[model samples]
Target: MLKKIFKQTIQINQIPKYFLASPKPNFPIDKIRNFNIIAHIDHGKSTLADRILEMTGTIVKGEQYLDKLQVEKERGITVKAQTAAMTYEYKGEKYLLNLIDTPGHVDFHYEVSRSMRSCSGSLLLVDACQGIQAQTLSNYEKAKDNGLKIIPVINKIDMPAAHPEEVAENMQLQFDVEKEDIHFISAKTGVGVDGVLRAVVEKLDPPKADINKPFKGFLIDSWFIKDQGVVMLVQVKDGCIAKGEQIMSCAFKKRYDIFEVGILNPEMTPQNSLTAGQVGYIFTNMKAVSDARVGDTFHKPDEEVEPEQGFQEARPMVFAGLYPDDPEDYMQLEKSIYKLALTDPAVHIYKESSAALGNGFRCGFLGLLHMDVFKQRLDDEYNLDCFLTTPSVPYRAKLRNSQKILEVENALMAPDDGLVEHYEEPLAEATILCPKEYVSAVMNLADERRGEQKEINIVDEKRFKLKYTFPLSEIITDFFDKLKSATQGYASLDYYHSGFREAKIKKLVILLMGEPVDSLSFMVHERRAHDFGKNICKKLKEKLPGQQFTVAIQAKLGSKIIAREEIPALRKNVTAKCYGGDYSRKKKLLERQKEGKKNMRSIGRVQIGKDTFVDILKN
Candidate 1:
């Protein structure tokens, strides 16, 4: 049976060139090279990708071609990992090179690792002026763990501050590569780019595949379009996939017919079919975006092929409640979120409600930056106004008089303080890189956040790297911003989950007129609870409008109130209405007014506006 399939594949490859409707990829398996560009944020990965496309004649020298998302363009950062296929000729031999340009921000590290699974080699980029950064080391470790061929490249050599030799020496010492092995290039000016391209074709090993085997591939990404349904980006591993082929997703246990198959030659260009070792997109009749799961394995319906080692499922490290600005737009907001989820499967979404804020979805993300980008996309792509709550990390607590443990992702879900056992907060191991001049300041900042020193290493004469263990909650808050400020924007941070630790954790709830406002509640460490409560109470006092009766704003933990503030009532002059009346009549009227206010205070509800919640939560 395998022999028969091999003969048929050969026959298909032998078909006359003119007989095909579109140009088919006929390169031999040995001539194909699959690789990705990995680096830290602002290291010129996109600029390098542009130069590669121009050199291969796949695209003209123009705007950054791979960063197609509006948020990416506006923020000058790559959010999604983009793919491009190019035909490069060297020494009169044609080669097929598929390049996956991955994002460098720590929030999108999943994209970097996922792209690594589909390729065998990576160009680890570092800005010559910046040298090794926090994410550069992180990505290098990922590449090493995946057993990928790493070709170190120093970018931005054209800059006056670039220190190519110095950077290469550090890379050699850190990555254990020879001094001559590092390639220096100015991706912006296209200098020394040809050498890097040559290295890709010669140094990287071709993928091991057998076209005769059953069709098998992994769905790395998927998104929705207006005219079409879910468009899936697949990395074919073992066999060939063509239009009309029936494929089954192991995750869904359902089969669907392929409507179209093509390669991303920087665009959705349809072709005859995609064979083993090719990265391409496929269109199917399946309309439900939820069905298009990333990291799913697809194979021929009739064949029994073991699933390949797929991508690691993305775990959300921070969660926030997202509510539409207008209550009437709940359904529209739900639809919009689903659409975004199709593109970013890392987001965790579930319907949730709040007493202060109406209907909303509690969404989880990889980090603060990930949550910010998701929110920005909601506004830019869907043109929808949204209100986001304070982001928090998931916490673990033990139930009272029971061994059962509870995981609380939102403050409202936290168990009562009488729980028999103690609480544990998520821990993270952070890698910080900074100039030696600011080492003292960075260490002080980290120490203030309850960080424990793990190790420290000197990268060069002027720079050093530090590893510290911190509560995940701290890292998700303003830690990054504070780090940048302390180091004068010279420090970079990357972190990973490092289990959990026992801590004095409590649920801090906000109360208005003695009524708990669920939306304003959050979990905090006992040590920081007092400060957190006081700050929030002050904010509420400034934001809440004065009511007819005095409104008391209090932050309470368990049965104790930690902070309190009052919004003064709007004083109305009943005497003004009684103008020129007798003094006894005016006194009687004042007493009546006071009595009504006291009664109203007993029964009246505090009128909290949407704007007030938005203001407090955002801060």
Candidate 2:
């Protein structure tokens, strides 16, 4: 039954002939070098890639082709993993180089992992000024685990404070790489970049795969294009795949007739077939976005081969409710989210409805930046205005009566206190790198976030690495910003899921004028509930406008109030018309005014404007 559905394909004649060019002359697989560039954020990975592209003439000068996303350009960071295939003549022989530029931010670690899986080696770039950082170590470990050869390179050698020799020694001591293998280059000035590229051709081993074997490739990344349908980036592991060939996904067990095969020369260039040890793209003419999943293996339909191992599913660390700014745009928002999810399978979305927010999706992300990028994409690509609730982490709750466990992604989905037997919150192991001078500030900040010190290692006299275990919930909100501010933007952080631990947690609920507001509620540690409640109530008090009747704002844990604040009512001149009347008439007017105030207190509904919600979230 599934085979029939998987057999669907678009007619081959519909695609342009330019997108299905003739097969190239067979080249020895030994001449191909598939590698990726990895480093800590702001360590010049993208800059190095630009230089490589220029030196090889794959992209013309003054062309911005790799960092195509607007967000990446605006922030000067690489968020997406992009591939560029270049042909360079080295040592009097033509060699094919497949270079994948990966994201450095921890939020996009999954993207880096995928890029690593497709490569035979990696260029481990480090900033000469900053030395080794948290992500540099993290990415090194990832490369090592993949059994890929790592070539350490020191970047920014032209800077005034450049310390290439010192950084090379540190890399040798920390990573155990020989000093002779370290390459120093200035990507900004194109100095020594030629040596780095030459080293790649000489040092990195060519991809070892048999061309005679049945066709098998791993899908490293996938996204949807308007007319192209689902375009998948694939790394050929064994044999060859050609246009119009029948292929099947080992993970989804779905079949597809390849509509097009191409290579990214910083732009999509058509190719008839991709043999073993090659990296390129394949269009399956798949209409559904969910059909092409990252990390899935594709092979010939007749041959049944085991899928590649080491594919880790992306787990969302932060969850939040996303609603349309206008209630009437619910359907439009849903469609937009679906479209966005097609491109970003890391984002988990499900239908959710709220009394205050109307229809929305409970979306999950890798971290705060991941959520922000997803929201930004929705606005930029779909032109949809969205309202995002405060981000929260997933918590495990046990029902008191049935002992049934529930995964609570949103605070609103949490079971009532009476129904919950106990709760366990997720914890993470964080590794922080900072200069020795700011060690005290980083430690103090970690302690304030309820982080427990596990170990501290002095990398050198000037820098150190500290390991701490923290509640994932605590660090998901404003912790990264605080860490940066505390260290003057010199600290770097990398973390992974540790496990779940029992926590003394309480649901902090906010009530406005005797009515509970679900949007303002949160789950906080019991010890910090009072402080959090007080802070939130104070913020709300300052944001809410004065009304005719006094507005009571209270934060409660179950039935007990932890903090309370009141917004004073606006004063009205109700007795001014009685200037010429007797004292008895004035007294009557005062009585009427007092009676109206009493009635208003009981019936007035506190209206929370959109701007007020935005302000509260920003605070």
Candidate 3:
């Protein structure tokens, strides 16, 4: 009788609902130092992130907490963005520093902008010797367009030839940054890193959130933490939350709780409290990771705040049909893409039925960099076989004859040429920084690609800079390849979209065995199609092995195939190289050639590589 009474009494004790939602944004602007770190590739954005973590005592000294990816450190390039939080105490006041490190490569602008939206300031890093390349200016422009305050940082200043003062002057003059604000530091040596930290403490104000109300925060980034499920790194903008409280992200319509909440120290500190201006992690109890997408907003259930803007579903800029190289691995590839999409929502894949490629969804991306990264990620993360179309960035136009706007990725996808009245091509305005001697070669190469010389500015007696405007279509495929070759990798170019204009553009498709191979297609001005065709034919002919019949290779534009080359059959009684049971090797080579002909594209008696059919455009 006593046990029954006790159990009934315990059950009678009522359980209350756990509350997790965002309150109003009474966040005072003064306390929020919303900023991001932006730089060119190899300019040390991730390394700097590590230094800040160390200086702020966020992680233990000598611990390698940043760039946890082996490939990232091995390749010496940051393929993705990294976010971390730190606290700087000065003048008897503690300040929270929210750091969002962004990719410097051209491909990651979408994610970069998403993260940039959460900040009001940006740190622009310029290589002292490399000066400002295209990506540096592009990222700066992204932040500038978002109306963020910029602190120009001249990184790699420890190098003997680093010209930090000149870089500062160039920034002040070239980009109009304040002279006093350029910070010169070597993130590797930790030199001047403290100065940057002090500047952050001195310059930026921490975020002031409405702590009196329910919890609302910004979802900066998200990734799966293995056995822990999904971990969301967020900034509580205007609210508070306790452990076991459930939260909802208005954008993704996801509800999760504070499974564990705290700053991501070297090892996270489980905290009972987090306030506005705090940078920390919010782990959810959900087993499904897809719900915790990055760049979404989180709030308590009933307490509402102003809806964050730019959460609109991102329209993919480039679309390509994806397929597994090995058809047997198609299912494995499909599963891998889902896992990739969970991390990078921008690299999207949806089901589509194509007449040619069959049932495969068109994959979408932000740019060539995004496409390449997606392809690489699938290969690396899932170890699956996959292939994607050549990267293309869509453009908009209405015919001069008819003002109906047409949005397509390039000349290939644009409406027929006759319908294209006043169609505009994307142009990249570039500044090439290099030693004075390479200026002519760089300028010449640009000209060869139909680039218009905008201006030539002298950087110094030993160095010079040239500005050029080229269609984005031209640069997307091979501009970097050519520029790097001509300059021997010494020249660095910076690019920015210079708007669209009426320009001559054409897509050249190279045909082997009368069938177009996707690999050989490229965008070129109509004027250079003939020479480009010849160069391509030459390159292909050099690569192809000897065969029994003539091989015809040509470049086609729509229905017109131009400049066909026919390779004659290898003549003469072929001498067999035979030594130590290898005597029939040459005869066997002939037999293999004849067998390959059976597999090559005939196009009514012409022969081409069976393997080369789809790979012609890759070069």
Q: Indicate which candidate wins on lDDT.
A: 1
| Model 2 score (lDDT) | 0.85
TM-score of each: 0.89, 0.89, 0.73
Candidate 3 structure quality by residue, lDDT tens digits, 1-619: 2233233321201212222122112234354455678887888888788777766656544534566655566556666656665556667765556677776766566567777767767888888866876577678777888777777788887688887777777788767878767777777766666667667656654554667767778777677766777777777777677688888878666667677887655345567756766667777786665676566678887767665666544456566767666557767777777777776666667765433333444677766666776777677777776667556655665666675887654344556656666446677787777777888888888877778988888765556778888777677777887888888887776665667876555667878777776545565567877887888787778767766656777888656777877777665454534444665777787787677656653534534453443354331
Candidate lDDT (C-alpha), each:
0.86, 0.85, 0.67
Per-residue lDDT tens digits for candidate 2, residues 1-619, read 2122123322222323322222242457999999999999889988889878877766655534578887888777888899988887887988888999999998999999999888889999999998999989999999999999998898887789988788888898889999888877777766667777888899899988889998889989888897668889998998998888989989788888888998888787888789998899998868876777788899998998779987887899898888887889999998889988888888889998766556788899999888888888888888998878888888999887785899987777788899888899999989999999999999999989999999999888789999999999889879989999999998999987778998987788999987889888788898889999999899999988899888999999978999999998887887877668579888887788889988999988988876777667531
Predicted candidate 1 versus true structure: per-residue lDDT over 460-519, tens digit per residue? 898999999999988787899999999999999998887888898988999989998887
- TM-score, model 2 to reference: 0.89
Lowest lDDT sum, 10 consecutive residues, model 2, at 1-10
Candidate 1, which segments miss by more than 4 Å at Cα?
A: 1-26, 401-403, 545-551, 567-605
What's model 3's lDDT at 132?
74
Residue pair clashes in candidate 1:
none
lDDT of 1 at 108: 88
Model 3 has a clash total of 26
Clashing pairs in 2: none
Ranking by lDDT: 1, 2, 3
